[model samples]
Each structure stands twice: as structure tokens, then as C-alpha cells.
Target: MQAFSKVLRLVELLLIVFSVWSCTQERDADVGQADKRTVVSLHLGIKTQMSSGCSSCELVNKYQWNFLYRIFSGKEDIEFVVYCSDENKREVEQNLLYDVLILVDKSPETDELVVCHGRKTMFQKAGVLDMFSMRQITELLMDSALENEQPLRK
Candidate 1:
């Protein structure tokens, strides 16, 4: 029954190949579905040396900025929009305060973080200069995104 034995081995090989192919296809489909999910927007405004005249402004250093940038840049569901006082003069001046209005809507300061879902403001925080504040902001953003995620259907 050499022919029968050969047939059984061939069938086993084919089954293994098909199982791998099926798993790969399922994983690809999951990734495609993830890409279709909504992306939340995070707007950040920071004052630079050029606009550092405000003595009361928060002291947001380069390292703090880089930390936020790294955490959000790698996330697929969050879109980070950074606005430097020196770099984006017009945009920051026009929309910084308008985009970030938490409890009391006032003028834009040195450091601000605004999380938005489409045009609506989901969360906002000001004077985010230290690592502790940054961590809080990160947790808030993640929570907001998770809250905004659509429930899956069975």
C-alpha cells in the first residue's frame, strides 16, 4: 500500500498549506478593517523662543514635545497636528484659541493640547509642559479614542 501512504502524506501537506494560507488571509482582513476605523485628531500648540515673551507661559522643553510626538506618531488611530508659535504664526494665531477652549474659552497660551473628533472638541488641556501632564494627556487621548470607537457586530 505504498501508493496509499504517499497519498496520505500529500493530503497532510496540502492541509498544512491551506491552514497557513487561511490564517494569513484572516490576519490581512483584520488589518484592512482596522485601517477603515476613524482617526482622532490631536492639535498641539507650543510657544518657541520667538514668542516666549509671556512670562506666565508654560515651559515646554524640546524633550517634552518629542515625547508626545513619538507616542502619538506611532498610533494608527490618532493624528497629531503640532503648531509651533514660531513656525505656524498665522494658523496658530487664527485657530489655536478657537480650537482649544476647555472650561473658559480664552486666548491661546504657550502650551495647549486639543483632542478632536472631526470638528468637535473631545478633550482639551492647557499648560502641558511637564512629563506628568504629558502622561495625563496621553491617557486622556487614549481613553477618548477608545470611547469613540464603534462597537463590533456579531
Candidate 2:
């Protein structure tokens, strides 16, 4: 009976150790994941003049931009920095010559999407707002994040 009790105690101790080890492993994994996460910054330069009736202004009010903002805002790795031409006159005058400019990760070395007047410039694989699909944007963002993970080339 004493031997059986000893064995039971050993099993209990083993289970406790296993549980602690499992928790440590999970915590390590979480930390690794946090390190791997890439921050994708979406810089939006918007025209605040509603009277201009520019396509870029119209695009801002459209459901697509709002929907995209809502979806991406919930993500852990994506950030949006909005710059209104009216509020940020110096920034607009210095960096942007268009009604709208969307820069990803603030890395001009990477492809950038510029929308102005009624035309849109493609950012590598991502097309203009009117022609760009949600899936394409998602892929673009994921691709950009992954690209940031790679070491810089000399």
C-alpha cells in the first residue's frame, strides 16, 4: 500500500512538472510570435476640401475606404496615419503633390500607391482604389510585411 501511494505521488509530481513545462513552452512561443510581427504603416494624405469634388475626396467617403480602415484598424500589425491636407498644410506641401497619397511602411524604396485627380498609380501588385480588390490589398499588406522581415541587401 505504501509503494502504491509513493507511485501515485510520483505521478502527481510528474503531471505538475509537465503542466509547468507546457506553460513555459507556450509563453516562449508567444514571445517569438510577438518578435516576428511586422508593423505596416499606412500613411494617407487626404484632401479636406469637399467643394473641390475631386475623385480622391469622393473616394474617402466611399464605403471601400471606410471598410478597409475598419478591417485593418482591428489588426495587430497594421497602423494608419492620416494626414489631412487642410490640417497638415506643411506636410502636404512638402511631401505630396496630389489629392491623395497612400504610402505603405513609409518606405519610398518600396512601391507606393498615389491617387490624384481621377487617376491612380499602381504600387507593385496593388492597383488603384477603384480597381483594387480587398484580397489584393490584403496580399499586398502581407507581402509588404514579409518583405520587411528579410535582411536588407548590401
Tell me, by TM-score, which candidate is best. 1
Model 2 Cα lDDT, one tens digit per residue, 29-130: 456454333332223423335444644342332344445455544444444333232444454345433323433222211112221111112232211345
What TM-score number comes out for model 2? 0.32
Clashing pairs in 2: none
Worst 10 residues of 1 by lDDT: 98-107
How many clashes show up per model?
A: 0, 0
The runs of at least 3 residues in candidate 1 whose Cα sits more than 4 Å from the true structure, single-residue gaps closed, are 1-61, 85-107, 144-154
What tens digits encode model 1's per-residue C-alpha lDDT throughout 100-151?
2222222243344445443344445555456676776667656645665633
Clashing pairs in 1: none
lDDT of 1: 0.45
lDDT of each: 0.45, 0.38
